[model samples]
Target: MCSIWRTLQRGTLRDIALVCLAVGVIGLSYGAVAVAGGLPLWVPVLLGLLVAAASSEFLFVGVIAAGGSPIAAVLAGLLVNARHLPFGLALPDVLGHGRRRILGTHLMNDETVVFALAQPDLPRKRAAYWLCGLGILACWPVGALLGGLAGTVIEDTDALGLDAMFPAVILALVLPALRDGETRSAALAGSALALATAPFLPVGLPVLLGLSGLVLAVGRKRETEVIR
Candidate 1:
């Protein structure tokens, strides 16, 4: 295992490990919430491994548990993960070729992309990307398994206040990006639109409507780029 991760520097290793620890905690919450909501233990565990996008998984679980259609849940998940299109476009080299590319894409998330971009060289970028991605892959499922087991013994998840955790964690994850003016504007607009339409629209459809705020963001970005 040490040899496998020999390419990562000590600082890189430490930062990635910290991120893994945080993700593990979020995964634990996801597992506990899902199981307590009446999902099978395998459901959350399998979703953790397969979906690998915490926010999207949370949205899916929330929608489904609220009596939304499976299609609606899946559409919401897709909308949340659409950011990966840009992610893939920016990191083709780190994704390698053929089988490695497939696995790299599967592991591709915001954390891995940010770490890869922060590195000074391509080799270091690849090292950081794979290290962080692999770390999260391992941590998420293990945490989910433990949380699922714990959920089995807990009789009242709502009383324990697990219900509010999904959105709270999602908000925490996106809070860092909101420091940017353009992103913040778009987020506020999108969020307001979603909340407004949520009363009349189907569970997942409001999220799609929320995405319309991206047009304003894209237009603003273009204006700024032209000015520069």
Candidate 2:
């Protein structure tokens, strides 16, 4: 507990709080959508607590709302979230080992990963990762609970512009990653594949297909090797 307090005082807490505020707002939007789509209030609340992956939760809720089968929804959610496999691979050091790794994996998300990677050193990275992760874990579920209850009263959350927040937040996150040439190339290729396939494919499949962007990364690596 004392260590936690010290961690909070270390200054990354402010950034974590700010990001979690956005996450909470997004969580509220997600809860409202889930209830409005005919899910029980507890569904979104539970998802916020357990699933905790905003994109996957949104995709799952959407599939269910569209009358997709539960099995199909689950598969879609898994497909959409498959990128986490690479994330886990890339951050093995930050994730640690044994019992702590279980909690670390659960807390892993785009914001936490980005915040941790942006830090200058290993200690700061670990601190930012855990702080952002734990903070989001708290804020997300609370926001979902409140939103689920309020969802019954509110009819059109889109009018409040919450609908735009998710993509805007995602774009903001990806923009920084694009600073790297290889990453930028991969993103462009992935986006093109996603867009081209979106009309004919199911929601999550486009994202899965976008994984082909790794080909660009491979090609970039080979080119760099040749140049060297």
Candidate 3:
């Protein structure tokens, strides 16, 4: 308990709890959506447990629902999940050793990685990582199950006023990192590029283009160097 409290001193526990809750709600909505779209109750629940990736699962569902190719949906999801490679690399210490490490990597997600990175030290990072990761792992699928069962009655989740919370949780997690000028510029440029291209491109491509914003931030570094 002392260790847990000490870890929370970096102001992680509350945010972790909120993030878990937000993802849980989103998962519930996903379940509701899947069932309403004619998917069996088991499908979303299974995906939630095995896939454990909200973005990828949603894209897959959207594609499949639209009668698009499953191969394309899977490929898109794989592309989205590729971002996890760096996430795994950046979080070696937090992952622990052996069996724990396997579970840790399995539990990894944007929320877990972000919360871990937000911490000031190793112990706190580990605490944040596990807390957020485990919490989401538990919540997301359960929410999906409940949502699937309820989906027959409530097909749409937008009415629940939850559309904003997911993005808000993400923004809250990332806002601190944006304090760095280069990161801030990169984020802005990425968001701008993503938004600008969204209409012209496909659903996931804009997000990939947004990563190119890091290149734009390089320009700022050059300007700063010349000023010095």
- The model with the greatest TM-score is 3
Candidate-wise lDDT, in order: 0.80, 0.82, 0.83
* Model 3, span 110-208: residue lDDT tens: 888888888888988898888888889999999999988877565556787788777777788789899998799899999999899989876667777
Give the clashing residue pairs of candidate 2, or none.
none
Candidates 1 and 2 compared by lDDT, better number: 2
lDDT of 2 by residue, 117-215 (tens): 776677767877888898899999888888888885556667878777657755765677699988888888988998999899866678768778879
Error of 1 at 136 (Å): 0.7
lDDT of 1 by residue, 6-29 (tens): 777787788778888778876777
> Which residue ranges in model 1 land beyond 4 Å of their true spot?
1-4, 152-228
Q: Least lDDT summed over 10 consecutive residues: which range in candidate 1?
A: 165-174
Off by over 4 Å in 3: 1-6
